[model samples]
Target chain A: MSAVVITVTSGKGGVGKTTATANISTALAAMGKKVVAIDADIGLRNLDVVMGLENRIVYNLVDVVEGTCRLRQAMIKDKYLPELYLIPAAQSRDKTALTPGDMIELTNQMREDFDYILIDSPAGIEQGFKNAIAPADRVLIVTTPEVSAVRDADRIIGLIEAEGKYSSDLVVNRVRVDLVRRGDMLSTEDVVDVLAISLIGVVPDDESIIISTNQGRPAVLQNGSLAGQAFRDIAARLTGQTVPFMELDGHDSFMKRLSKLFKL
Target chain B: MPNDRIKIKGTSNGLVITLGAGAWPRLVEELDALLGERASFFKGGRVALRVGARLLSTADIEAVGQVLSKHHVTLWAVESEAEETRTAAAELGLEVELEPRPISPEQSRPTAGDTILIRRTLRSGQVVEFPGNVVVIGDVNPGAEIRAGGNVVVWGRLRGAVHAGMNEELGEMAVVCALDMSPSHLRIGDYLALSPADDSRTQIVPEMAFVHDRQIVAEPWSV
Candidate 1:
């Protein structure tokens, strides 16, 4: 079956691009779909560590692109899900090592074998980012609720549109609803107002998410993680399932819940 | 020396860089250096090239195109006197010639009373600069910038930096207005005004900004 190549990108670093890629791919795989994740950040390879496939990477994306190894040789099977795989980036090489054509060629070979190919793009709008987006059938822009992240997401949306890729869904990650309720942080609406894009997911800031990430078990596989549920909802939407946006606050005051309910 | 070899003129289509007779490689190097100096101005711009009587192969035109692309400029058409140069440019799918705007004594410069209408959003890091007035029909996000020699107007939200009456002696006469007047900063001629650090206004109103008493002041638009 042909796979839909979805490039997950964030213009600003530290905005959960790699984390989202790992979790979303894992969630999709757990749903009985074949999935693969490619880390396009060559020099700063972290997706392997995030995916807990660091030790399993003998051949990388550069090796596959340079024909030093077979494409199947570079695919590292996921630890938690048999249906998921990851093509790690080459830690020693820079973004210049892989061209846009190489990325397109690599994804094209994987398309026949997988249901979804999620490319974790580098932080900047450089060669790495371009390579990741060149073959994308869809784009998912990840951003935090902060103004800088939202602004960068807007910039990424513009660049994607310029590339003739018309559709991009926004993923607001690491949002602190407490701060948002206190009127201290930007709300999801504020971000969507500035970005003017479709909101696919809003992953709340959770301490357990960091813990699960450190253990190489993405929170999506965890039992009681709010961020995990948010990513699961994202995956559910991706698979053509209608999942409503979950309430981030489990302990919101009754007044707040009532107001939210009324608004909905 | 570079100015003598290379000349930049803005036509109705876009900027045109006219190259004097020289060795191909040296001319290309000179053009690259000139563009690198004003890289920001040329970025996201599409320009034509006028190679006077100089024969170019497809590779030569492509080499120049590579240089322009390095600076985020696009080479769309090539104006050449030599038939060989025109044929090479055409072979590479470049327009051999643009519909020339005849120059007149009164219209020696195309900037006079000229205004460009931009119909799309200017996202972060996108910039629009013109020697005449500028009007944008969409929002200008925070890292975007607009520079105009005359008046500036945005029909939607404007939250970017804008410089009106840019490099013009009649800078104070240039006015800037938008439906929402939130901007990073405003510059009219030499005057500068910084937006407040906190955006407390929940309501958005169409406001016009102009220089008053040697300072830029924005007021709610009237009429």
Candidate 2:
């Protein structure tokens, strides 16, 4: 089966692009799909660490592109999931070591072997971001609810549209329901209105996500975490499933009480 | 085939280059080579490009202008049949129409108003400029800008910066009207004003802004 190459990018740094990529890849693999996650951030590679496979890396994406290692030799299989693989970036090299053409050719070679190929794009609108999206069938833009992050997301969306890639979507991360309810933060609707793009997922702010990252494991593997559920829902949506969005604002009970009072 | 893409003709005003149909990058490359071939003949010359029916973005037009400027050619105007291309040229503060040929009085004067009607939203980082009046049917989001020689009107929200009455020759009588009139910065002629920080309430009536006593002011739009 041919793989769908999805690129996850954020124009601003520390907005959880790497976290989202690792979690989504894990969620998709847990659903019995063969998934390969590529860390396109060459100089600052962290996907291997997040996936808890740093010690297993014999080769990397730069090695494969430079023809020093075979593609199979560079792919580090996950310890728990047999269907998942990780192609970590070269720590010693920079973004210039890989070009857009190399990314496209490399992904094309794996198209027939996997069901999903997710590329974790580097921060900024530079060569690394271009390389990640070069072979993408769809793009997921990750952003926080802050104005600065939303502004950067808008710029990235404009660039993606200008490149003639029409399948780009948005994923709002680190959304605090309490802040939204208190009118201190931008709501999901406000972000969607400004960006004018379809919303794929809304990941709430969770402390377990940081804990999971520190322990070198994606939070999506934790069944009890709300952030993990959000990633799972996003993965389900990616696989053509219609899962309802989680209610994060704690307003459902309030609304129900208000309706009951009106009836009484 | 390469030579046919760019046809240069000398005129009394300047050189008029007719750019043939093709991709924008290839056209830029060919124009670069053509300029390089006859640098002395084209040096210190004004150019009016005749791009027939091709819609060019701001970046594409800027690239072409840069190529000409590198060879000491000043791009004074751009003549195009496409409305988008004309608007793009006008946005760069370049004349959309070339210098008039010897014309009869009837052909020289027209009866229509010089106003541009834009029906699309101006997103962040997009700029629309014209030497005449401008009427937009969509929202002007934050970071977008509009510079007009005359009046400006927005049927939707006006949260972006706008400079009206840019051409002093046209008389400083320009006004800016918007359905929701909270702009980051507003200018009428030489006067400038910023939206009040605490005025976050939604506007119920349309508002018009104009220069009054050497300062910009906004009032309820009536007549």
Candidate 3:
């Protein structure tokens, strides 16, 4: 089956684009679908480390484009999921090393072999951003519930529309159910109303996500974490399933509620 | 193909056509030939033709005016340091006054009273202004703004800032409603309302906001 290239991007940094690419790729592959995750942040490579495949980098995306290696040689298989692979970005080189044409061509070739291609886009609306979206069949914007993040997401959505490309969606990451319940944070409705785009997934703020990231195991691997379920639901939706968003209303921590009560 | 024509520049006030040197009959003939070639471009256009000291009788000015009229163009005024051309233009009922300066906004702010509808959400950092009603079918994100002289309507949530009836008092109302109503600030006339905490577990339904007792108050949208 041909791959569907989806770019995960956020205009603001540290909004978890790389983590999303890793987790979504792993989850889709776990479902017996062949997936390839491409780290489009050429200079600042982090997807490899997050996916626990940092040590096995012989050929990178630059090598594949520059004819130093075949496309197959550059794809590093995942540690646990054999159906998943990652085409790591070049750590030593900068974003200018690869052109948008290179990215488009690489993704086109990979599409013939894999069922899904997830691109981890770098932050900002620069050359890196262009390279990431140049080959995408769909774009998933990741943003938190904060005002600043939503603001940046708005700007990115405008730019995407300006480029004459349509069919883009939004995913609100790291939502706190407790804060939302207490009216201290923006809820899913708040973000959707502001962004005015179709919502695909809403991931809750689970501390287990941080622990999983540090250990090079994406939270999606746990199969029980609420955030992991969210990612899986997102993958299912991407595959044309009508999975509803995983509800996080019952998981609000007692301490979180207590802090809200004391603050008010 | 006739290069014997005067060149014209368009300004807000009128057109300025610079005359070329030639025999009187030849010049008139050339002007006629030139206007004929591009009649559509100059149709219904008002012109101030500049002829530099070319001696002309009333007949010459009449001939030029006739040629201009044939192309549906009006000769508004004549520009020249030449005394004779000015006298001829004044004799032909055309104004001899200097070209008028462009009217600035200080001279006019005539409201057309036209309104523009924005069908998409006004996201953060997006600003829109209208002299009349501003209707938005989507959300107005925080840090975004909508300034209108008449009224404002938001079909979705409005968590951003908005100002209505900017030039007047609370006469012009600002209404913002969404499935979830939360705004950084909402202003109508002189009244402003800072957003309160959102209510979760409450299925957000459509709501409408308006100025109440010099403050912004929201009510559930009903028929």
Distance from true location, Cα of A24 in model 2, Å: 1.4
Docking class of predicted structure 2: incorrect
DockQ for every model comes to 0.14, 0.11, 0.10
TM-score of 3: 0.61
Clashing pairs in 3: B156-B178
How would you encode candidate 2's per-residue C-alpha lDDT over B135-181 as one tens digit per residue? 99888878889988888999988988999998786535888999989
Point out the worst 10-residue segment of candidate 2 chain B by lDDT.
B104-113
Could you give candidate 3's per-residue lDDT for residues A1-264 as a string of tens digits?
A: 788999999999998898888889999999999999999898899999999899999999989989999999999989999899999999989898876657877887778888999999999988888888767789999999998898899988766653335668899999988799999999989888668889999988888788888889988898457788789889999999999666577664634664576688
How should the candidates be ordered by TM-score, best one leading? 1, 2, 3
lDDT of each: 0.85, 0.85, 0.78
| Residues A160-234, model 1: lDDT tens digits | 764546669999999998899899999999998888778999998888789987988899998567788889999
Worst 10 residues of 3 chain B by lDDT: B105-114
Displacement of residue A122 (Cα, Å) in model 3 is: 1.0
> TM-score of B chain for each model?
0.57, 0.60, 0.47
Question: Residue A129's C-alpha lDDT in candidate 2?
Answer: 83
Q: Comparing 1 and 3 by lDDT, which wins? A: 1
Docking class of 1: incorrect
Listed in order, each prediction's TM-score against the native is: 0.75, 0.75, 0.61
